[model samples]
Target: MNIWTFDQEKDLNTTGAGLIAALLQSKPKAVLGLATGSSPVGIYNELIDMYRRGLVSFANASSFNLDEYVGLPVDHSESYRSFMNEKLFKHVDIKLENTHVPDGNAPDPDAECAHYEQLVNDHGPVDIQLLGIGHNGHIGFNEPGANLTGGTHVVDLKEETLKANARFFPSFDDVPKQAMTMGVASILKAKQILLVARGEDKAEIIRTALRGPITTECPASLLQCHPNVIVLLDRGAGRFM
Candidate 1:
């Protein structure tokens, strides 16, 4: 695991975007595993700026989002698909068909999971996978547990997760009770993993996930088993380090 601490927010965003831009530059057809939520918004914005300035191009790249809320419509404001399009994809020149976000509204979630896994197998190993850690140390929607799933699957969102996401909805009850997320094994398949975190709220979990024991109890800790992982943190989030 390689850890980076930045004093300013722009530096953190630029660092993450730079790594991705470098990947796209070296391999125009590189596949990117992306994440949604507040942590990655800044990085996505930076990449959009890079695209506008001609500093980088995503014309030939492909992307897959890590997770999506189960039962949400693709057009829903909070859906991962919408989040990606609004934050990054629409700004770049990448083909819309080349980007994939799991269908959260699929009638048979099990089937959707299998189909998504097969898709990953077809276009993977992902060149780089981006991630954001939850306050409870979850990655994607893989909450802390005794045994973790190893393939794409539907999961009951933990209370902490639901509460954390409440801010995105008008009320706590509006937050989805379930989610479809890539498994730890699926994520580790990536050739490279980039984990981004910011703010003091994430400090303890960041430290635990990075320096603490590698166990299923902290899902993000599983990244320690991967050969290549990069951790980018703003100073507030790196406080415990």
Candidate 2:
């Protein structure tokens, strides 16, 4: 694993953007596994700038998102599908057909999870995966010690995750208790992983996941086993590390 710490969020975003640009230059049809939440907002913004400048094009690229809240409608303002469309897909040339996010409202939720994994298997081992560490070291809603399913599946959100994510909704009651997420094994199977974090709130978990022992106690610790992971952090998030 490689680590890069920047003085501010802008610098962090720039560094990540440059990395993605280089990857695109080398592999135009890269399979990109994406994540949402505030940590990746800057990266998406930088990608938009690259698209405008002709430094990169996502025309041939395929993308898969990390997770989605299970009960939310696709059009829900807070849904991951809506978040990605607004933040990244709408700004780039990525074909909507090439982009995949778990269907939160699938009537056959179990079938949806299996099919999502099958889709990734057919189109992946992802060329690059963008990830964000939850305040408690959860990754893709796979909270600590949930048996570590090796494929995409539904997850019961931990109380800590619900509390943390409640900020995005109108009230704590608006937060969903369940989510569908790519599993740890699925994520680790990616060819490369770029883990991003910002803010003081993420400092401790970032420290634990990157510098502490690898354990299922912190799902992000699974990244420690991956050979090609780059952990990018703003000073605020990396302080403890």
Candidate 3:
């Protein structure tokens, strides 16, 4: 994996935006795998700025999000769907029909997972996938464990992940215990993977995933095995390295 360390969050975001612009320039119909969380917020903002400036256009591109809470309604403020609409989709020219986020409220969640995976396979392996590592090194929602799912599936959230994500909810109890996420194998299958991290809070996990041993105990460490993985970190997140 290649590492790109930036001095500040804005710089990191700019670098990410430039990468996306290059991708769009080369393949306008690129299938983008997106991540939802604070780490990616600045990157999405940078992309929006590019869209407004006519330097980037997602008009022909399609997107699939990495994961979503399994039980929340789509309208829930903390739901990934709401997060994407507020942070990225609303400001871009991407087609609504081409956007996909797992339905957290689906009555038959197992079937939902299968269909989501099939949809991604139909249009993928994704041209580019953006990821955020959990404090425990989980990618998407594939938390640290001996057995990680190999396809899209529902996963119980790790405590560290719940705590990390609690910033989006009112209380720890309000956070859903489960999430629907693309599996580790699925994420690694993307043609290109970009993992972004910011803040000192992520330092330990970033260091472990990048410089430490590879193991399912720190799920993101598995990225070390991928041929086209790029890890971008701000100074704070790279401190441990």
Please identify model 3 stretches exceeding 4 Å from their true place.
Answer: none
lDDT of 1 by residue, 8-68 (tens): 9999999999999999999999999999999999999999999999989898988998999
Q: Considering every candidate listed, which one attains the maximal lDDT? A: 1
Query: Could you give the candidate ranking by lDDT, starting with the highest?
Result: 1, 2, 3
Give Cα distance to truth, residue 143, candidate 3, Å.
Answer: 0.7
Tens-place lDDT digits, model 3, residues 1-241: 7888988778899999889889998999999999998888999999999999989999999999999998898988889999999999989999888999999889998899999999999999899999998888889999898888989999998887888778778889999999999999889889999999988989988988988899999999899899998889999898877
Cα error of candidate 1 at position 196, Å: 0.4
Kindly give the number of clashing pairs for every candidate: 0, 0, 0
- Reference-based lDDT, each prediction: 0.94, 0.91, 0.91
Model 2 misplaced stretches (Cα beyond 4 Å):
none
Best prediction by TM-score: 1
lDDT of 1: 0.94
Worst 10 residues of 2 by lDDT: 142-151
Stretch of 10 with least lDDT, candidate 3? 159-168
CA displacement after TM-score superposition, residue 32 of candidate 2 (Å): 0.3
Give me candidate 3's TM-score against the actual structure.
Answer: 0.97
